[model samples]
Target: MNTTRTVRLGLPILLLAATAGLVAAPAAEARSLPTYTCGYTLDQPQFDSVRGRECTASAGAPLIGHHWITFQMRNSGSGETWVCNSVEAALVPYYLDNKIDPDYADFERAYGRGADASVCHRLLD
Candidate 1:
């Protein structure tokens, strides 16, 4: 009789423990953010490619649908200050509030204006 009762209690405890572990696994092993790059342009008739899309983690703005981003170009000309803007279509959403990876933040902070769409992580609500 005692053995039967003990087994009932033990099974429930084991099941509860298993459930807790299962719930925590995904949160612990969540996927990390991939790298992204944005483009930079110069003030010229033919917009020359000064730099390739560089990685960044600037996830401040809330992106709805496909977000469009315009980054002002920093002039590299000889003492000539000029600003040029380039717009990226369908910018990817890259940050979440609940969890942030300490090792690295999302691309919004890292790449600033030099990030492109290749490395965007869709956040879970």
Candidate 2:
């Protein structure tokens, strides 16, 4: 009779311990932000080549996007400074606050007037 009672109580404790482990796994991963890679390539009338690769931790909602946005330019002759070239390999994308960013257009326009993306160190939202 005592053994039966002990088993009943131990079973619930075992189940509770298993549940806690499962929940903690995701929480630990969430605490550590995942890193992502972003590529940089530039093309213009004078120069065209793959600049380099960059690393970011953005969650893909606010700033991280397909096109790498330019925050600063390198002062190229034709304004295609290829700023992203000199920027740090690891950078944080600009947050848009879920609204239209005038600087987004400015960055695109300053690089080379490229319809898709410009040369810089940032990514699209």
Candidate 2's displacement at residue 11, Å, is 0.7
TM-score of each: 0.28, 0.27
Compared with the true structure, what per-residue lDDT tens digits does model 2 show for residues 1-125? 99999999999999999999988775444442222233333444244222323322234312333444333322223333333322222233433355475575434423422222233333232
Each candidate's lDDT (Cα)? 0.37, 0.38
Once fitted onto the true fold, the runs of candidate 1 whose alpha carbons sit more than 4 angstroms away are 26-125
Q: Among these predicted structures, which one has the highest lDDT?
A: 2
Q: Write the per-residue lDDT of candidate 1 for residues 91-113, one digit (tens) a residue.
A: 33434353455333245432444
RMSD of each: 17.0, 13.0
Clashes of each: 18, 3
